[model samples]
Target: MKMQAEVIREGELEKRSDSLFQLWKKKLVVLTKDSLSLFPDGHKRAKGKELGFGSILKVDCVERTGKYIYFTIVTKDRKEIDFRCPDQSCWNASITMALIDFQNKRAIQDFKSRQEMEQAAGKR
Candidate 1:
């Protein structure tokens, strides 16, 4: 499937799995205007996992210990996805900015819709 939005950034990052062991998997991460996509190494047919901005509630920078910076992406469903990468990569900041932009656009659209509804109600 083709993505309609432009890709903001693409790189590899260590994703912390939700399993009991909390294993870190190295996956290729692609950040677009609408979603984040993950792909396995050299995988051609797999679509991998896509996390849309609408389902993402917030992005949090948890801590920075030595070489790696820790961050978490919290979904609207209350699920937390953890990630850590090299201090120089700046993956955490990039993702946070993109998510914020998407959220702000969504908020503006919601406000406009609500205003239109209120005006229609007043007219009736």
Candidate 2:
């Protein structure tokens, strides 16, 4: 669900549809590159799928109490989630990831924008 603007040379503009001129297309250039860094280097793409992440969609974290943190993750199909974990390490990563996901969700206009991705992807 990303887009780009590419100019056509000569008189090719008239041959193509207006949508082709500049439209938001689901291009894998960003996904594949991201997949490479998120997953292992030799990781292979899942078969028969537009996205390798076939199940889980997003992750969220919430501070429940003084010593408790909650994780709320939604699936690709809008599934409900209410998970609570007392583990500090897990909760820390969860909170960090959620914060990063929010800050870098779509603030950048460019796909190569690695602002939020790095903070979340780091080995903390």
List, residue by residue over 1-124, the lDDT tens digit for candidate 1. 9646798988888999878999988988889988888887725257779899999998886799899999999999988899998989999889989999999999999999999999999999
Per-residue CA lDDT of model 2 for 1-124, tens digit only, reads 6643221111100011125353322211113311201112223252312222334566655556655555554556876344454445354353344334444644453444575567678956
Q: How much is 14 displaced in model 2, in angstroms? A: 59
For model 2, where is the 10-residue window of minimal lDDT? 7-16
Best by lDDT: 1
lDDT of each: 0.88, 0.37
Q: Which structure among the candidates has the greatest TM-score? A: 1
Worst ten in a row by lDDT for model 1: 39-48
Clashing residue pairs found in predicted model 2: none
